[model samples]
Target: MDVIVETRYGKVLGREEEGVRTFLGIPYARAPQGERRFLPPEPVEPWTGVLDARAYGPICPQVANPLNPVDGFAQSEDCLRLCVYAPAEGTGHPVMVWIHGGAYVFGSGQSPWYDGRAFARDGVVLVTLNYRLGPLGFLHLAHLGGEAYASSGNAGILDQIAALTFVRDTIEAFGGDPNRVTVAGESAGAWSVGTLLVTEAARGLFQQAILQSGIPFQYRTPESAEWFTAQLLDALGLSPSSWRRLFDVPAADLVSAAARIPARDGLNLRPVLDGVTLTQSFWDALRDGHAAHVPTLAGSNREELMLWVARESEWRALSDEERIARVDRMWGPLTDRARDYYVDGRTGDELLTWLVRFASMRTFTYPTIRAAEIQSEYAPVYLYRFDYRPSRLGAAHALEIPFVFGTYAHPSARALIGERPTHADVSDAMHAAWVAFVRSGSPQAPNLPEWPTYDPKRRSTLIFDEAPRVEDDPDSAERELWSDMTSLSM
Candidate 1:
C-alpha cells in the first residue's frame, strides 16, 4: 500500500514493506541548473499536489568510480534529494541522517549498500541524502565571480544543510523527532560530518554525530583554490577573467575536465576555507572547543590505508629500503623511531604488512585520535577501532560499513570483506552500538564491552572484534611518534 505523508513542501507518496515505510527521491532543495549552477542551495518551491517518491532520485553528475562501481542509477544535475525510512508504527523516533562517501567525487544516498530498513527495524528513522559532487559542487571561483558566487566552493555542504533543514521541518510527519537528529557518514561523508561540526549554518540542526573512518584535514585557501581554478580554466581553454563562461559549459564537459586532473597532483576537489561559509579551519574550531556541544562517536578501521595500498602495484612492490625511505619522507624525524616501535624485526610479507599498517596509522588513525582528543574536551566522545580482520582483506578502509548497517550479506560486502562468511554476532554488536549511540548519547550494546568516554588521560577506545574489548591508550607509542606534527599527509 502507498503511504502518504505531508512535508513542508507538499504531500509525498511512499511505500511500506515489512513494517518499514520508505519515502525516496524527495527533493530538499531546488535543482542547481541554469542560473543556480555553482551557487549555494536554495529551498524547494512548494508543490500543488502529492509528489510521487517511490523511486530513488538521479545521482549527482560525475564519472563513475573505477575502484568502486555503482551501476543502475541514473545520474543528473537535479540530484539534491534525500530518502527516508521509518518504522511503520512509531512516534517521535530518534532520527539518523546518513551522508554517503566517495572522496566527495561519487556515490549517492540511493546506493544499495546504504539500505536503511535495518535501522528502521531497530526503532531509528534513517535518512540517506544526495549532494552535489566534483567541480560542479566544490570548484572555487568566488574571487573571480564576486559576491554572487561567494559560496561556490561549499555548495555541496550547503546542499546537505538544506536537506537537514527539510528533515528538521518535515520529519515529524514521518514519525521522527526533530530534536533528536544524529548526523553520520563514512569517508568523505564523515569528512562532511566533521565539517558540519564547525560550520555556523549547521549549528543546532543535529544533536549528535558519528564519524566513521574520517577526520578534518586541509581545506583550500583562496590562493590554493584559485590555483586549481586556473588549472580548470586552462583545461577548458577559458581565461580566468572569462570565468563567467563556466556557467554556459555543459555539465559533462566540466566533469570530463575534472576527471582528467591527475590524482598525484594532489588536486582532489574539496571544500574551501571561504571567509563567509567556512570562516575558520575545522581543526581550529575543534581545538578551541567551538564545535557544537553534542555527544560524538568517532572511529577508524585498524588498517585504513590498506584499501589503497592493496590497489597500488608500485606500493605493493616496494623494497624494504624503499618503504623505509618513503616512510621517512612522510614522517620526518620520527621515521626511525616509528620503525623500531612498529616494524623492527619483521621481514618479507610480514614486513610489507607492517609497513602498510604504519602508513595507515600515519595517514588515518592518528588524525582520528587527534580529533577525538580535541572533541572530548568539549563533549563526551566515544572512540573505537574496527579490528575484525576478514580472510582476504584486513580491517581496512570502509570494511565496517556493512557491519554497521547490518547488511553484511549484500553483494557490495564482497568487494570490501571478500566472500568469507560474515559473523552475525559482530554485526549485531556493531549495529546495536550505533543504535544505542543514536538513541542515547552512549554506545551500550549488549554484546559489546562497556565503551567509556575518551579523554587524554585514559585515551580509552572500544576495539570491535569477534570478542569486543575496551583498551586504554592502545598503540600509544606510535601515536606519540607523530604527536608534534601539525597534520597528516592525507
Candidate 2:
C-alpha cells in the first residue's frame, strides 16, 4: 500500500516494498534552468495535494561512460530531485543522506546501485539526491558581484545544501530524526560530504559523516577557478563582456564546452575554494579542527588506483622519455623518493599503471587517511580498508559499493562484483558492518574481530574481506611517501 504524508514543503507519497517504504523523485529544490542555471538552488514550492513519487528522477547531465565516454546518458538541464527510503511506518528513525558520485559529472540518485531499499530495511531513513553537474553546475563568471555573484563555481554543492535544508525542515514528517543525521558518500559524493563538513552553512545540519574514497586533493582556489573559467570562455570565443550570454545557451552546449577543457595534469572544474560557500581548502579546515566535534567514518579500498591505473595503457601510449614528461606534467616533478617509488626505470603499461596509482593515491586516498587522522583527534572516527580482491580485478575503486549495500545478487552484481560466491559472501559481511555502523558510530558486527575507533596511537583499521580482520595501518609506507607534499588549497 502507498502512504501519503504531508511534509513542511509538500505532500509526498511512498510505496511499501519488502518491509521498506520508498518515496522517489521528490523535488527538494526547483529545476535550475534559464537564469538559475549557475546559481544556488531555489526552494520548491509546497504542493497542496498528494504528489506521486513512484519513479526515480532523471539523472544529472554526464558522460555515459564514466571511464571514457563514447556516448553519454540522455541529457537534460532540469534535473534537481531527491529520493527517500525509510523503515519506519510512522516517525522517529535515524536519517542517512547519500550523495551519488560520478566525479561531479555523472551518476544520480536513480542509479540502480544506489537503491536505498536495503538500507531502509535496516531501520534507517535513507535519502539520495541529484544536483547540478559539470559546467551547468560549476561555472564561475567575471560578472564581479558579491557573495551572490562572486563565487558561482560550486552550484552543484549549493544544490546539495538546499537538499539538506529541505531534509532538515521536512524529514521529521516522513519519520526521520532531524538532529540525528549522517551524511555519507563515495568519490565525488565523498568529496561533497567533506565539503559540507567544512561549509559554515552546512554546519549543524548533519551530526555524523562517512566518506568512502573521497578525493581530498581536488579543491581549486578562487584564482585557479577564475583562470579555468577564463580559459573556458576563451576557447568558446566568447569575450569577457559576453559572459552573461551564458544564461541563454543550451545546457548541453555548455557541458560539451566544459568537457573539452581537459582535466589532466591537475586542471579541472572541481569544487572551487570560493570564499563564499567554501571558505577554505579541505586540508586546511581539517587541520584546523573545523569539524572536530562531528563523528566520522572514513576509509579507502586497498587497491584504490588499480582499476583506474590498469586502464592507463589506453591513454595514448608514450615513450620512456615521454612517460617521464607525462608524469612530471601530471604531478609536476615528484620528490626523489616519490619519483623512484613510481617511475624508477619502469616503462610501458606497467609504468603507466604505477604512475596512475601514485597519482590516484596522491589525489584521493592519502587525503582520505589524513582527514581521518585529523577527525579522529576530535571525534570517534572509524577507519577501514577494503582489501578483498575478486578473482580478476584487485580490490579496486567503487568495489565496496555493492558490498556495503549488500546487493550481491542484484542485476548489476556480476558486472559490479564479478561472478563469484566468495565475493558475494564478503559483500554481505561488509554490508552488515556498514549497517552496524549506521546504527551506531562504531562498526562492531557479530562474528567479526573487535573494530577499534581510529586513533593516532595504533593507527588501526578494519580490513573487509571474506575473512575480515582488523589490521594495524595498511598503507603507512605509501602515506609517508607523500606526507610532506603540500596540500591543495581549497
Candidate 3:
C-alpha cells in the first residue's frame, strides 16, 4: 500500500488504492507567495527528507463557484501542486495531464470531478495540478508595473508549462512515458490546451491535446487586459500611480475586488496578450503550423452556453425590447440581418432555443471549428459534438465531464447526467474513445464509428450521444450563422 519514488526535486511517499498508485500534492513549482506573487512560476526548490504526499495540496485562493466548489481543499498563494495516478504494474504507460476549468476564475486540480482512478485503471498515468487563477494569476500588470510584471497576465499559462515540464522530468519514475504525454482540459482549461498548442514555451512538452468546449482564441488583448487591470486597481481604491499597493493587498481581498471587475462585451479577467509570452493569436499560430507536431482531439457540448443561461429565469422572461436591445448591442448595423436569421418570427422557447444556439456558435462551436480547420491543414485533427441531453435541460457546458472521466456517480456529475442506466453506457463508450485517442493518434474505439480526420472538405466529426456516430459537417447550416462574422459576439 505504501511506495516511495525519488524525484529530482526529492523523494516522496505515496499510497496504492485498488491497482493504482496515487501521489498527491507534489509541487511542480515553488510557492508564488510574497515577492513571487504575480510573477511567472519558478522551478521548485529541491527538498530534503521524504515528503509525505498523502493529501491534496492547497489550491489557489479563489471565491467559490456554486457549481464547481473547491471547499474541501485548503487554499493558499503557494498552490502549484499536482496529483498523479499511475498503474501500479506498468512502465512507460501513456501520460495524461489534466488542467481543470472554472472560467479561469475558480476550480482546482483537487476537484472530486477530476478523480483520475479510472484513467489509472485503464493503464494511463493521469496527473492533475493547480495553477493561479483570476487576478492572482492573470491580472495584466506590465502596462502598469513595467518589466517586473511583463508576464503577469500569462502567469497561469506559464504555471501549466511548468507543470508539464515537471511531468516530463519526473513522471518516468512513476511508470509514465515522458514522450507520450497528452495535455487535456475542459472550458477554460480547454482554452489553456488550445493556447498551449501555440505557446512557444510549450512546443515539445506535450504530444497530443484534448480540448473540450474551448478553442485558442479567447484571450484578452493588452488593451482589454489593461482595462480589466485598471478596473481591479480602481476597485482596490488605488490609482495607476499606486499600483505597488497591489502586492500588499490580501489575496482574498483581490478575489473580492476581481468579482467586481465588470465584464465588458463578455470579456473576463483571463489569459492576456502579454506580447512576450504569446506573440500571435491561436489562429495565426495554427496557420503557421505551431501545433503541427501534436495530434488534436477537440469539441464542444451541443449547448455550451446553456449551462450559463438555461438556469436563469431572466433569460426566458426577458421582454422583447430588452432581448432585442441585447441583440442590437451585439450586432450594431447588422442588427436586422441578425434578427432575420435568429428572430424572423420565433418567440418563446423557439426564440430562446435560437438565442442559445447563436450564442453557442459564436462563442464555442465556431471557434472550435476554425481551430480544427486550420490545424487539420498541418496535422491530424479530430472534431466532435457532444449531443447527449442528460435531460430536457440539454447537454449544457461541462456536462460531458462525468462521461469523459467516468465520474457519473459523483453527486455533481449525477446532477448533470441523471440516474439513467444508459448514462453509464454512454460514458463507457466516450471514455474509451478518449483513451484510444491518447494511446494512438486516432480516437477509434470499439463502440465508435470510423472517424476520419477533419479537413475543410469532409470535416468528419464524431458525435457522442446515446448512439455514437460519425457525421460530415453536422449542423452545417447552424455553423453558417457566423459565416461573415469578422468579429465574434463573445
On TM-score, the candidate that comes out on top is: 3
Off by over 4 Å in 3: 327-335
Per-residue C-alpha lDDT of model 1 across residues 272-301, encoded as one tens digit per residue: 898988998888878766674889999999
In order, what lDDT does every prediction score?
0.86, 0.77, 0.86
Q: How well does candidate 3 score on lDDT at residue 319?
A: 73
Q: Which ranges of candidate 1 are over 4 A from the true structure? A: 263-267, 318-348, 419-422, 484-490
TM-score, every prediction: 0.94, 0.92, 0.96
Candidate 3 residue lDDT tens string, 1-490 = 8999998888989999799999999999999988889999999999999989988889998887667566677879989999999999979999999999988889998887889999999999999999999898888899878998999999999999999999999999999999999999998899999899999999899999999998756578999888888888888899999998888999999998898776884546777778899888777778888898689999998987678677667777787666666645542323445678877798777877777777777678888998888888788999999999997568789989878889988987776667887898889988998899888978899888899999989889998999999999998876665666556522
Candidate 2 TM-score over all chains jointly: 0.92
Residue pairs in candidate 3 whose N, alpha carbon or C atoms collide under 3 angstroms: none
Candidate 3 to truth, TM: 0.96
C-alpha displacement of 206 in model 3, angstroms? 0.5
Residue 110 in candidate 2 has what lDDT?
Answer: 69
Query: Cα lDDT for residue 186, model 1?
Result: 95
Residue 36 displacement (Å), model 3: 0.6
